[model samples]
Target chain A: MLDKALSGSSRYWTWVIALMAIIGIGFVFWVQQMIEGLTITGLSRDVTWGLYIAQLTFFVGVAASAVMVVLPYYLHDYKEFGKLTILGEFLAIPAVIMCMAFVFVDMGQPIRIVNVFLHPSPTSPMFWDTVALFGYLVLNVVIAYVTFGAEKKGIAPPKWIKPIIILSIPWAVSIHTVTAFLYSGLPGRGFWLTAIMAPRFLASAFAGGPAILILLVLLVRKLTKFDPGLKPIFKLAEIVTYAMLVNVFFVLMEIFTVFYSQIPGHMDHFTFLYVGLDGNTTLVPWMWTSTILAAVALFLLLVPKLRRNEKVLPVACGSVIVSIWIDKGLGLMTGGFVPTPTHHVVSYVPTLPEIMITLMVYGVGALILTVLYKIAITEREIIEQVK
Target chain B: MAKSTRRGFLKLAGVAAVGMGAKPVYDAFARRSAPEQPTPPAEALTAKRWAMVVDTRKCLREHGCTDCITTCHLVHNVPDFGNPKDEVKWVWKEQFEHGFPEQHNEFMSDDLRHKDVLLLCNHCDNPPCVRVCPTQATWKREADGIVMMDMHRCIGCRYCMAACPYGSRSFNWRDPRTHIAKIDEGFPTRTRGVVEKCNFCAERLVRGEIPACVEACKAKALAFGDLEDPESEVRDLLSRHFNIRRKPGLGTQPEVYYIV
Candidate 1:
């Protein structure tokens, strides 16, 4: 099964090489960051966290979203998803890896990372996050290996894997919940101190996660002979539609609660994000763009005609991914920091080297994803041809 | 039958016992003939819970005085990057509106409205920084309630910084050693990438000396004493004045109080 990734067409090799080049460039910048410290980044005392943390947050949702496919296929015995579940599991493997990479790069003392485990504080959400993420990653890897191997051999995945598959369902939810706890539990951070944070995270994850999966699935269809069929893709787009609707509703809920209650601590952050707080409006344009794109995505996904149209479906999925990307990856993390606890507004923008390092982590995720997908596609092609 | 002789014998015995007791006292006095005496060291300051009170009335009376800030930064070996972005501060001055934003009002007295207030780590009794620290690098000391930072253990995740409601913590964005104007050999300078802040002068308290900031304030605006002790100065001050802590509604129970 591993040998399949090694033997590929020139096009496959070109894609692999291109991701490798990105990984190489990113690695260099990461090393430079290690030497020079986070001073090279656009972070400050006020905005202590920035791009790395936001990416970690967004990718965690992507990793957890795999459960959407796994749950329907495994629990309901949905045969239409038989081909798509493996894609979901393979997608999770790199998403989790990207999450780990982002956490690694975000640390000021990356060398002392072992201290989290050595002297673990159960009180800390971050410690629980580490445990949850690592556990989810292991669960997906084992499930993918066993199930995919059984598929290649044309036998049932051993009886033992069923319980493990069921356990992953909740584990997926836990990873994102714990990640949300990392921010939401903080006392002074009014933006994240809402009961809806975990729900919002899951909703956005379900929307954004499957949106990316749809794009990857389309890419697989174009590059390989293994088609997952149209029914499963349409079903996933429907899931994206509802999840995105709920995600937007959660955002509106926050807005209503903050504005109605008229708490300066809570209202100030939303004001900073949507409009300008004081004179600083760096995130205003980004926030509005995310809002408009989300509206566009919801519009595309809601209409059955546009959604089923393959060409327009990809456009909708792209819109969902970008919309949620800006919402979670750009706005969410930085918004919490602005209108700093002191009531002074400070904005953050990622530096070039910081962006480079972030891209490097993404490149690593892409490389792992490409290789895993290549292997899965080749196996699916062989099985279809024999049938 | 021998009463006369027995009485004389009893009297002699009583005199001998009295002489025996008095002999050691006389000997002790004769041995320490010198006037000079060795003095024992002052006892290390101990408090069930340490707290500070900033008398804003006294603090603002003298304008443009950074005595406390200078002394604290110098004593702690805090670096000056000459810019706010990379600045590492232990004790610093913050404006009244910014320091106590919750307390700020539109129609406040002008004297109290725009005055500069001294600010440092609140060392909250329910410190969120301690609770959120993944590595247990920052913790509220069980003995004195001072939030302690173990720089070596901090992975520089900055979760503590984010969790701190008062904005008390500062991260070493660069090598702090590079920017220190003069290094204090007594206090260890922090390396780049670890979150650090005011330690409430735990080191000074061990040597039976007060915090440098409190000592440096010429106006005597800063009061440091045990919050738990009813007899302590801070406790007495809190009882007298209408005081406030930054973001007290958050329930962090900040030990630092402002005497409004």
Candidate 2:
């Protein structure tokens, strides 16, 4: 059984080698980031947090969304997702790891990150964020371990594990909700201060996260003989559609409040993103593209015919993922800074060194994910041999 | 000779003289225990909350008050960036319209074009920055009601920078000492990547000295005192004249009030 699982064409090795090369280039870039400090990034006083944080914020949601399928399938005994639930759990391990990696790279003193625990600041949202992140990481690992352990034993999971699984559903929601509070609770930043921000964050996470999972499932089918079936994928996509609708609705509410009230503080940020405030048009194209893509993707997902087609489904999911990434990751940070409180135009452009560092962090996350999944797959093969 | 010395001492010591000489010292020592006795009621102890009232109208547009900003920043080891791109300021002066955009009067003249206002952490009664700080790095002192930042605990997240309406907070982007040739002999420069802001010269306040900025103000335009004390200089000044605060409607109730 182990030999059969290991028997793959040379193409798999080629792909692995190629990924390693890309990762190597990214490492060189990270070295430059360390030497130059954050000045190498496009971030400035106005836009204090940029792509790194935005990606960090978005990915936390993606990691938490894994429970959307896991809870209903496992605790509820929905056998439709029995074969695919492990894949979702495995996917969460990487996403959560990546979320943490992105945050570490964004820190000025990555070495002193342990100070967060050594000298905890109870008032800081960041402290809470750290607590939530580490908690979710532990929960994911434990859940995966217990489930995989039961699989190896060829028996139902222990009764105690059931309570733990049930508890994780809301724990999953809390991780993303706390992440949203990190932004929305900020009082002065008009773009992020809405009460609806947390709900919107969960919605987008549910939409983008499940979409990525569906795409990954499709890739697995094309590459290997494993077929998890389309039933679970369609069911997950249906959930994704509703989440996307809610996400878009909250965004529209944000727009309406800003425009209708015409409060200069709130309007200024929107104008900067949409209408090019004070001749700073850098973010205009990106914002508009995200808005259009999100609309199109939502429409496609809502249509039964389009969503049912495997070909169209993947494209729609990819589009929504990219759209939300741009909107939440880049647009949110850039827009927050325009017409700065001092009314100064401080532009941020990600320097080459900054981009390289970002790429390096991405490569590191990918590396961790690759190794973990490989170990899990290898373990399964060993178990099959024993059987 | 002994009899003469005794006679001299007797002449030197008079009962009335001794009593006069020791009276004040005895009184002072007796009063020393007075503070130990709890006599004041709750109402008397509740002095008015400390606040500031700045007269923006009296501002002469001269940069003399920059001494206040410089002294405060120097003492706090604030990084001085000749380049605006890397500029990090715990305190600075802003032009009039920038500081009070809504205070446009029809009679305002061009000569006041560059009229500047000293800007620092408002130390608001209801500070949003304090509310948003995840780590409680920024906190309000119940004693004097000054909002302060604890640099060591700051995670360099800069959420306070985003949450401040006054744009008073600054982020240390690089090593603060990198730009300076010699560290000021006394004050240590900050580490890179943490948020720094006007602590209202809290260290100086602790030492029974006024904030450096207030001390350096040549025009004596900036004043610092307990607003709770009605007879205190700041309270007296506020009662005597009309003063304004930056973004009053934001409901932050800034301690750094200004008059225009």
Top TM-score hit: 1
Q: Ignoring the other chain, what TM-score does chain B have in each prediction?
A: 0.83, 0.76
Per-candidate TM equals 0.93, 0.86
What would the per-residue lDDT of candidate 2 be over residues A1-387, giving only the tens digit for each residue? 223324445866676566677778877866665555666677777777887888888788778888978877977888998867777777777777777877877776566566565555566677788888888888878888788778867887777877787777888888888888877776556777788888888889999889888998888777655666898989988988998999899889999998999877788888888878878888889889998989899988999999989999998998899989988888877777766777766677887777776776676666555555554555664666633
Supply candidate 1's per-residue lDDT for A100: 91
Candidate 2 vs. true structure, TM-score: 0.86
Quality of candidate 2 docking, DockQ: 0.19
Score each candidate by Cα lDDT. Answer: 0.90, 0.75
